[model samples]
Target: MENKFKKITSLWIITVLILFVVAIILGLLMRFNQGGNIKLDPVTFYTDMTIHGLTMIGIWFVAGMAAVNYIMERYVRTSYKANLIAYIMTVVGVLMLWGAGFIGKFHAGWTFLYPLPFKIMWEQWATPLFLYALLVLGVGWTIWTVSLMISLLKKYTLSQVFAWQHFKRDAKPEVETPPFVLISMISLVGVLSCLITAAALDFLLLTEYYSNGGFINDALLMKNLTYFFGHTLANEMLYLGLAVIYELFSEVSGRPKWKTSWYVAYAWNLTLFFVLFAFLHHMYMDFVQPETLQIIGQLASYLASIPSTGVTIFSILVAVYGTKINWNLANLMFFIGTAGWVSGGIGAVIDATISNNFLLHNTLWVPAHFHTYNALGNVLFSLGFFYWFSFQLKDGIIKDKHSMLKILLIVIGGIGFLAAFYFAGADSVARRYANYPEEMASGKFWATFGGTFATIYLLGIILFIGGILKRCFGFVFSRV
Candidate 1:
C-alpha cells in the first residue's frame, strides 16, 4: 500500500510539473504579446489566457491535495482508489478543457461568466464541452475530499477531528488532534463548500445551454455563484498547502511536531466561516449586488486573513527564532513561501477594500496580487513538499549541491516578474489587453520586463524539476 501511494504521488508530481511548464510558457507568450514583441489575434490571446489560468489553478489545487493525501496517511487510512480515480478524471477533464479552448476556440475567460459563454463566438459545441469539463473535474475532486474527511472521521470523533477540546480553557483531551488534522479538516470543509458551488454553477450553465433560450438564468445570481466558486476554491487551495506546512515544517527543520492548541483551533475554525463570505468582495463593483453583501465582503476579507495568518506566522517565528535548526531546501521554501503569502494577502486585502476596489477593479492589480501568492507563495509550499517527498522515498534528505542556486534563481526571477505587474498596476494599466495603446505605452515596457523575468523563473523551475523529476520517475519504475 505504501509503495502504491508513492507511485500515485510520483505520477501527480510529474503531471503537475509538466502542466506548470506549459502554463508558464503560455503566460510568457501573453506577456510578450502585450509588450509588442509578438503579435497574436485577440481571440488567440484570450484562448491562451483561458487555458493558462484554468490550468494553473487546476494543477496547483491538485498538487496541494496530492501532498495532503500523502501526508494524511500518517494519521488515517485514506482511500487509494479515490486518489487514483481523481488522478484519472483530472487528466481527462483537463484534456477536454484544453480541447474546448485550443481546438474549439472557446475563450470566454476562466470565469466563463453567464451570458458570455452563450454568445458562442467559437465552435458550436465548445460551450457544452467546457461546461462538461468542469463537471468532470468537480465530481472527481468532491469525491476525493469526502473520502479524506471520512478517513479522519473513522479514527477521530467529530470533536476530536476539529480539536474542539482545545476550546475549553485548560482542558486536556485524551486524544489530541494534530495541527495537520485540524487545518486539513478546516480547509476541506471550505473546499467541499466551494466545489458544491462549482457543481451548482456548472449545472445552471449546462441547463441554460440545453434550454436554447427557453430558460433564461439570473445574471446576478450567476455572477455571485461564479466568484463564490472561483474565489473560494483559489483561497482554500492555499490553506491546503498551509496544512502541509503545519504537518511537515517542524519535522523538516528538525524541530518537534506541531500540535493543535486552543488558539490554533480557534483561528482555523474562524477561517472556515469567514472565507465563505469573503467572496462577496468580488461583487463590490456590481451595483445590483446588495450593499449588505458588499459590506460583509469587506469585513470578511479582513477577518478571514487575520486569524490564520496571525497564528501561523507567530508559530513559525517561535520555532525558528534564535534556534540552531536544520535548514534544508524544503524548510527554506516553506519559510519564504509564507512571506510571499503574507505579502500577496496584504495586496488582496487592499483591493478588497471598497475605496481601493473602485480604483483597482479590472486593472493589472487583480493579477498582480494573485500571481504573488500563487507564483511565489503557494507554488513554493508545494515545491517544498515535492522536494521533501522525493528525498523521503530514499529514506533521507540527499544533499543537492545546486539547491542554493535553484532557490536564488527562483527568488530573483519571481520577484522581478511580479514587480513589473505591481508597478504597472500602480500606474493604472488595464489588464486583459492584447496590446497596450499609445497612452499606456509604459504598459508595454512593463510587460517586456515581466516577460524577461518570467523566463528566468522558468529556468529555475526547469532546474528544480530536473532533479525531482528523475527521482520520481526512478521511484515509479523501481521494483522495490
Candidate 2:
C-alpha cells in the first residue's frame, strides 16, 4: 500500500519536471523570435506562449505543490485518500484549461484582465469556460488545503501548527514538531488568498456595467488580484523551501536541530508582508495606478527584502560555519538551493528600486531573477526532499550514492543553464515579444546558449528519472 502511494507521488514529481523542461524550451523559442523580422502567425505564437505561461504557473507551481502536499502527508502519516482525490481533480482541471489555452480559446494572459479577454476572444464561450476552470481549480485547492490543515492540526500540537493554537482539542494524538511549522499555516493563508482573489477578479471581469456608463472599470483591480496571488505564491514557496532546508541540515554532522534565533523566525514572518506589498511594484507601469501607491509599493518591496535576506543568510552561515559539511546529495541540494535564493534575492532587491526597474522590468532580467530563486531554491529543495524520502521509504531503494550524484548533476545543470538568461536580460533584452529591436538582435546568441544548456540539463533530469523508475519498478513490480 505504501509502495503504491510512493509510486504515484514519484510519478507526479517526474511528470512535473518533464513539463517544466518543456515549458522552458517553449519559452526560449518564443523569446528567441523577439528580435527577428520573421513574421510568425500571431495565432500560433499567442497560443503557444499562453500555454507555456499557464503550464509554468498552473501545472508546475500548483501541481508541484500538490505533489509536495502528498509527500508531506506521507511523511507525517496522514490521509492519502483526500490528497489523491485533490490531485486527480487538479490534473483534470489543468488539462482542460491547458487545452483551452492551446487552442487560443482564452489567451488574455493568466490574469485574464477585465474586458481584455472579451476584447480578444469574440467567442462568448471563452469567458465562461475560463471562469469555470478557475472555479474548479479553486474548489480543489480549498478542499486540499482544508484537508492538509486538518491533518497537520490533528498530528501536531496547536502551538506548532498555528504558532498559537486556540482550538479546543477533541481527539487525535499530538505529535511534537520542529520550529518551522508556521510555514504550513502561511501556505494555507496564501492559497486561500490566491483563490479568493482569482474569484473576485473573475466576477468583476465578467460583470457588465450596463447600468453605468458601460465602461468596464476593472483596471486597477486585476492589478491587486494578480499581485496578491503572484507574490503570495512565491512567498509560500520560499518559506516552505526554507523550512525543508532547515530540516535537512538539522541532523547533518551534529548540526543544531531546527533551532534558530527568534530573530530568524521573526524575520521570515515579517518578510511575508514585505513580499506581499512588493507585488504592487509591478503596478508601477500601470498608468491608472495612483503615484503614492506605487511609491509605497516600491518602499514595501525594498523593505520586504530585509527579512528573507537576513534569515536566509543567517541560517546558511550558521549551518556552514564550524560544522563538517556533508557533501552528500541532500546537503549539496541545500547549498545549491541557498545559492539560487541568494542570487535571485539580489536580483529582486535590484528590481525593487524605481530607477532600476525601468531597465529590467519586462526584460529577461525579471525571469532570470525569479528563475534563479524558484528553480534553484524552491524546486531543488523539493527535489532534495524526494531524494531523502525515497531512500528512507524502502531498503536499498535509492541503490547508492551514484544515483544521488546523477540527480544533483541534472538539477544543478538545469539551473546553471538558465543563468545565461541573466546576461541577456542585462543586455536590455525584452521578454514576451517575438521580434527584437535592431540594437538587441545580437541577444539571440545568449538565448541560444541558454537553450542548448537547458537541453543538456534535461539529459540530467532523464538520468534522475531513470533511477526512480529503476527503484520503483524493482520495489513495486519486479519484486527485487
Candidate 3:
C-alpha cells in the first residue's frame, strides 16, 4: 500500500508539472498576442484563453489536494483508490475540455458566462462537451474530498476534527487536534461546498441546453453560481496549500510542529464560514443583485481574509523570527509564498471594495491580483511540498545546485510580470482582449513586458520541475 501510494503520488506530480508547463505556455501566448507580437485569430486566442484558465485552475487545485492527501496519511488512512480515481478523471476531463476548445472551438472563456455558451460560434456540440467535462472532474474531486473527510472522522469525532475543544479557555482534550487536521478539515468543507456548486451549475447549464425552449435559467442566478464555484474554489485551493504548509513547514525547517491554539481554531472556523459568502462580491456589478447581498459580499470578503492571514502570518513569524532556523528551499518557498499570498489578497480586497470595484471592474487588475497569489503564492506552497515529498522519497537531499539562482529568477520574473498587469490595470486597460485597442495603446507595451518576464518565470519553474522529476522517477521505478 505504501509503495502504491508513492507511485500514485509520483504520477500525480509528473502529470501536474506537465499540465502546468503547458498552461504557462498558453498564458504566455495570450500575452504575446495581446502585445501584437503574434496575431492569433480571435477564435484561436479565446480558445487558448479558455483552456489556459481552466487548465491552470484544475492542475493547481489537484496539486494542492494531492499534497494534502499525501501529508494527511500521517494522521489518518486515506484511500489510495480514491486518489487514483481523481487522477484518472482529471486527465480524462482535461482531454475532453481541451477537445471541446481546441477541436470544437468552444471559446466562451473559462467563466463560460451564462449567455455566452449559448451563443455558439463554434461546433454545435462543443458547449455540452465542455459541461460534461466539468461534470467528470466534479464527480472525481467530490469523491476524493469525501474520502479524506471520512478518514479524518474515523480518527477524531466531529467536534474534535474541528478543534472545538480548543475554544474553551484553559481546556485540554484527551486527544489534541493537530493544526494540520483542523485546517485540512476546514479547507475540505469549503472544497466540498464549491464542488457541489460546480456540479449544480453544470447541471443547470446542461438542462438549459437540452431543454431548448421548454426551460430557461435565470441569468443572475447562473452568474451567481458561476462565481460561487470559480471564486470559492480558487480561494479554497490556496487554503489547501496552506494546510500542507502548516503540516510540513516546521518539520522542513527543523523546528517543532505548529499546534492549534484557540486563536488558530477560531481563525480557521471564521475562514470556513466567511469564505462561503465571499463569492457574493462578484455579483456586485449586477444591479439586480440584492443590495443586502452586495453589502454582505463586501463585508464577507474582508472578514474571510483577515483571520486566516493574520493568524498564519503571526505563526510563521513566531516560528522563524530571530531564530537560527535552517533555511532551505522548502521553508524558504513557504516564507516567500506567504508574502505573495498576502500581496495578492490585498489586491483582491481593493477590487472587492464597492467603491474600488467601480473603477477596476474587468480591468487587468483582476488578473494581476489572482496571478500574484497563484503564480507566486499557492504555486510556491505546492512547490515546497513537492520538493519536501521528493526529498523524503530519495532519503537523501539532492542538493539544488543553483537554488539561489532559481529563487532569484522566480522572484524577479514573477514581480515584473505582475507589475505590468498592475500598472496596466491602474491605467484602466481592459482584460480578455486579444489585442489592445488604440485607446489602450499602453496595454500593448505592458503585455509585451509581462510576456518577457513570464518567460523568465517559466524558466524558473522548469528548473524546479527538472529536480523533482529526477527524484520522482527514481522513487516510482525503485523497488523498496
**TM-scores vs. true structure, each candidate:** 0.99, 0.84, 0.99
Model 3 over residues 316-384: C-alpha lDDT tens digits?
999998887888888889999999999999999999999999999999999999999999999999998
Give candidate 1 regions above 4 Å deviation.
none
Best by lDDT: 1
lDDT of 2 by residue, 328-364 (tens): 6666666777777777878887976888888888888
What candidate 3 gets wrong by more than 4 Å, as runs, is: 396-398
What is residue 183's positional error in candidate 3, in angstroms? 0.8
Worst 10 residues of 1 by lDDT: 392-401
In order, the Cα lDDT scores of the candidates are: 0.93, 0.64, 0.93
Q: Lowest summed lDDT over 10 consecutive residues: which window, candidate 2?
A: 164-173
